[model samples]
Target chain A: MKQDVVIRTVCRLIVPFIQIFALYVIIHGASGTGGGFQGGVIFASAIILIGIAFGLPDALQRISEKTNTLLSCTGLYIYAGIGILCIIFGGNFLGYSFIPLPLDSAATRGLMAEIVEIGIGITVMAVMTSIFYDIAVKEDM
Target chain B: MIWEFNFALFLFLILCAIAAITVRNLLSAVVILSVYSLIMAVLWAEMNAVDVSFTEAAVGAGITTLLFIATLSRTTRRSED
Candidate 1:
């Protein structure tokens, strides 16, 4: 897609703010509404926007396949890692009570929720970008 | 935050849905579908689902429109029926 230079410039400016807001959602999920799945998809949109206006080559240049894989895994593992931490702390598997944060158990739950959101965001970003790339690579017209 | 503002968005989506399915021209229908997606995105945002609203705006309004446009190239732009 050959976007006008002005359109491309505008998208470049706007998309990063979208990403930042997505991160804000992910972080504040416990305090507000939307959790992991929702925040994740939003964060992914930033990259997708870049792909839309600038094309896949430019988008991919910024976010490599390797980084995508790593982040996707990291997001999921953050969730899993907590379970492992709970077990190591001699508590039930995935139990939030075992968390040793400075705050109360309720606050700990909030922290855990944020961590999982981050993980979900990474995975969503990667998978959605993959979808965009697949579309971009379709057979000739 | 804006309950009255959201009522307008809801009405917009309903209108888009009606236009999408009721249109005679296939290309026009497809374009309406994209509009429906955008309206749906706005509705989601009004409901405070920023995450979902964002995705809907990006995918529904953005990618899905492209998909419909691309498909339009290969398919007939009007229903024969």
Candidate 2:
């Protein structure tokens, strides 16, 4: 059997740490300036690393192009819904202060920020994965 | 002025970009692009954007290089000279 045939133990060590670090950036964006886009890219990077060390065909087995496409569309919908809910409540779009959630106080702003970050993460990760798939399959689109 | 740093990064970006374009060697081009990213990352950090630097390192250094190699392998090694 080939040494690289099995999933490398090094990947198990590295991937989790990268993911947790990405989350740290996403949640702590208020003062630090890192946000959903950056965190999402990093998260996608981790998955991509696995894709590289393993193989494209195997990676696709887990992430599939269809799933990536679905996530890409769903992320935008989530972001748009936040704005729609704000407007429905008689507030300006993205006026996150008006979001009617269980949370109260300035925490609401944090809540809105975090949600938007998550949306960004979803879109970036999904889109990036699709980009990899596209290039891998060599489908001109 | 921020222009100073911008100019430095721009210079590296341009030179590497030209190398990637003009040279027939695909691998060298990819390597030069990695250097370009490193320079750009440094510029971002100088501008007090640690987050952008982090992202640039991950995307530019890690993923972009990987993509290039993978794509390059799918094609031929030698380019039309």
Candidate 3:
């Protein structure tokens, strides 16, 4: 399919804002009405829009399949690592209070919660984009 | 104030849902489905489930619509009777 100039220009102008808002949702989930799942899906929608506007090749250049796979793994590892960290500190799995940050335990737990949310967001965004890419691309003869 | 707005959203949601299922052209059905998703997002927001609303808009309205269009491009536009 041929790319439309208007669509490409509009998407270029809008994508950055969408990404920024997704980040805001992720970071503010602790205090507001958002979380990793919602933020990640929103971020993936922006990337998917880029793919629709520019084409699959352009989107792949921005985030290759290899990079997507790696990021998915890294995100899961980060989540699991936090749980292990809590275990090491003599707390149950995912007990953020055991993290021992410079702040008070409650604040440290909040900080850790945000980190966990980021990990979940990364995995979700990568997986959704990868699934779309795999479905949309045509196989070579 | 809020209840009236919610009632309007719910009405629109039902209309979109019926349109999405009954439309003959595949592309139009997809567009109507997207509208349904958007309306559902608004309803969720009205209920204070911001996270669910955000997910519905991003995934259901946005990505799913794109994927539907992509698939539509690869296949027949008309539904076979």
Evaluate candidate 2 and give its CAPRI docking class based on DockQ.
medium
Worst 10 residues of 3 chain A by lDDT: A132-141
The per-candidate count of clashes, in order, stands at 1, 0, 0
Per-residue lDDT over A85-112 for candidate 1, one digit per residue giving the tens place of the 0 to 100 score: 9899888877877888889998887677
Please provide, for model 3 over A4-69, each residue's C-alpha lDDT reduced to its tens digit, 9 standing for 90 to 100: 899999999999999999999999877788888788888988998898888888899999999999
**lDDT tens readout by residue for model 2, B2-79:** 787688778888898788778778888888888888888887888888878978987898779878976886788778
Candidate 1 residue B37 Cα shift, in angstroms, is: 4.1
As a TM-score, model 2 comes out at 0.82
Clash pairs, candidate 3, are: none
Which sequence of candidate numbers ranks them by lDDT, best first? 3, 2, 1
Considering only chain A, what is the TM-score of each predicted structure? 0.87, 0.85, 0.96
Candidate models: Cα lDDT each:
0.75, 0.79, 0.88
Q: Identify the runs in model 1 with alpha carbons over 4 angstroms from their true place.
A: A88-93, A138-141, B1-15, B22-27, B37-81
Q: After superposition, how far is residue B46 of candidate 3 from its true place, in Å?
A: 1.6
Task: Give residue A27's error in model 3 in angstroms.
Answer: 1.0
